[model samples]
Target chain A: MMRRFPQIAPPLIALAILLVAWELGVRYGFLKPYQFPPVSRIASGFVELSTIGFPTGVSIWSHTLTTLVRVLLGYVGALALAIPLGVVIGSFQVLDKLTAPLVVFCRSVATLSLLPLVIVWFGAGELTKVFLIGYGCFWVMLSNVIAGVRYVDPVLVRAARTFGLHGGELFRRVVLPAALPRIFAGARMALGVGFMVIVGAEMIGTIEGLGALIMEARTFYRSEITIIGMLIIGVIGFAISAGLTALERLLLPWAGNLDAVRR
Target chain B: MLDHDNLARCALRRSEAPVAKRTTSPFLQFIAINSVGKTFAARTGSSISVLDCVDLTIAENEFVSFVGRSGCGKTTLLNIIAGLEDATQGQITIAGRPVTGPGQGQGVVFQQHALFPWLTAVDNVAFGFRKSGLNKTDRRQKAMDLLTLVGLEAAASKYPREMSGGMQQRVSIARALALDPQILLMDEPFGALDELTRIELQHELLRIWEAQRKTVVFVTHSINEALMLSDRIVLLAPNPGRIKRVFDVDLPRPRSRTEPRFNALYEEIWDELST
Candidate 1:
């Protein structure tokens, strides 16, 4: 940790400078407090949200947990369906060609644009939010998984075949492991999609997430609380991606740097 | 402290014994490539002939090399011999049995090492024993033995990416040998390495060949490499690839590049290749 001080110090100094500048701007007549929300107010707002609770009973922890659970459910559901379907589609050239246009069309449709239809189908409730998040995540994850399986190095397959491996045995031993780095890349991308979809999904017919908290606080003219909620969402997003990167490192030490694999 | 010259002489005598055996039974061909040819159909509807009517017969436990320039179909011929690809015309047989497809006792080491990046060195070698009916522990032990043979016992647990290019090739050789096949097919196995590493691996391969005598069919672009390792060097020509000439290298074992005979053979092969 001590050896990393040089690398860590610059980012810390920059963040401190930015916060101080923002705080001073609000203190003077340079920036409006309602729009910018002074650092001190946001900090105090964070403390109140955690302890005194937002809208009487729901704390910041409850809001964060609700958002996390919703994201996890949709993300997991999307992956569960996407992976197997992607593998089957990727393995057969005929299937891949047949579904290419359909997949592209579905993935192109905006997630939030389907809000009215989803609300009609599932009613504006928890089910509707989950369905929307799943929809956004599924197509991205599915496409990535298909590409992963399809683009496995031909040399690797040839080497395996020389060992007499073929059919399911070849797929299990060589193709699947070769495609893992790509699959993990897809999972990370899908999670980002799921997170983005949930925030928008939570804003509608829900008063129990960080997104809902921001929307509710803005209506009550608590700009500080809104800023605080936004900061929390950023923190959650950063933490989740970092956690995923760590998990990828632990699981796939042989994959080398994932940044090279991410396309 | 060791008598290096005497050891070389002993190795030379052993190597020469095969030549005498070959003369006695010239009809006993181990691997017979009968009019083998390969052609690829291009996107423009024109068929590209890579190899044409190539005929060569390798004796059992003999070291033969196919040497030529790029587009000479040396690797194409090796792939056909390895059963990874089929010939457009003709056929290849091992010990009188026609090769239908890959994996009938033919082990190949590719130029790129082709070691599965996900598996460690030991596991990669053990993969060759998938059909051996051996338990996991036994297979691992056998893999370790092969690694030791290639002087890479310490790198048994290392992944392919963790090892150097030379070390990866050593692991690849170990994996190929783990199959304990009747013949070993190598396509420029050390072609990507530096000159010094390539020379060192050439010696290492010779040592392995002496220890485990198998019919070795090696493909290389280097005439010097072919001269250094093979008993007979089959020079191939490109543009509808065909054999130009076959040179018998009767040099002694532990052969030096500085030797007059070695230089002469190199010049002869070079002269043939230039035309």
Candidate 2:
């Protein structure tokens, strides 16, 4: 406990010092409270958003849950479609070559840039937002899965072959397991992309998410509420990545240092 | 020294008491390699021959070792015998049938212990029984038995990553034996291990071979290892790899390096390798 204090102490002290300076600057009229909003105002904003609600009825909880639901839907949808397709593509050299250019082009196309076209097509509803997030995640996931499958240890295939395992049996038993660490790396990356896309996605034409709450607070001069919303988004993103790391650890006890293996 | 006197007597008795089929040679050739060759395409577009016109015969239940320098195609020859790689020009026959592909009663242990990381030691061993039609429980039980045979029963539930290098190689040996193959092809199975572990595993391997009575073709760069384990050692020369010589190790079991005969043979092989 005593040893850990040194590790934890520096960051806390720095944050405290920063907050005090901000409060002093605001009180001395050197800084504007409306823009930066002192720490105390942000704390009160958190309480107000949690209790009396942000847009007269919907609480911060509802906004967070809505954002989370959108991300989960997009992320899960992308993984479900990408993994199988990627495996097939990665297995065959002919197919991989044929699709390589298309995949690269699609991944290079910025997902948010398609928002205007998507809103025109899908009418700026939940589907439009979810589609944008899915589009962002799918390409990242697909490419990683393909790479993972393509680069399994050749010695493992030879060993499997010696045991009368060939064709699809070899792929399922040997290739898939060997590729799993890379696949997990891909999943973690895809989730991050999904999280980033959702925040930007929810900012436009969506009133029931953290992104929209912050945007609405900005127009109403509630800068403190906006800051609170941004903090909540950051916390949620941290939680999401932590949860994914935990899941990866749980599923792959045998896979030591997957990050080290990944490029 | 091992109890070789009794073993020699037993072999003599078995040969004398053998039934009807009479042959000029006392023991039948288990694996016959006839003018085998291998060539690979070079990056410069010219073809490079790795093995050229190699020929040899191994008797049933005999332990043979292929000793050679790097690039000598000893591994390639072993792979051909295991049916993992096809010979460029010649044919190999096992049990009177021509080799085509993997799965002709040939169990191979590579230099690297290629046990699947995801599976426990038992499961990796049981991988040999996947197509044998045994249910999961029976496979696990049989795998446990093989692990016991390799003296790794305590590590049956451990993953490959969790085990030491020597232990992992033991698991690899157990996994190969799970097939109940008539011939075991080992490609320098102890090459990556330290000296002590290599010697220990060498002893363990000899014990297993004695009990199983299977035809073993072991490939190694170590002359001492070849002398210690093999009934015959075939020396291979590189640069279009071909057989340079074949030495018969007629010395008694568990032969000592201090013995004059052992030192003489080692010197001869070392001189041959140096040239």
Error of 2 at B210 (Å): 1.1
What is the alpha-carbon lDDT for the whole of candidate 2?
A: 0.88
Report residue A6 deviation for candidate 1 (angstroms).
3.7
Show model 1 residue runs off by greater than 4 Å: B1-27
| Docking quality category of candidate 2 according to DockQ thresholds | medium
Give the candidate number with the greatest TM-score.
Answer: 1
TM of each candidate vs. truth: 0.92, 0.90
Worst 10 residues of 2 chain B by lDDT: B17-26
Residue A58, model 1: Cα distance from true site in angstroms: 2.5
Looking at candidate 1, what is the lDDT of residue A231? 77
Off by over 4 Å in 2: A1-6, A29-31, A220-223, A259-263, B1-26
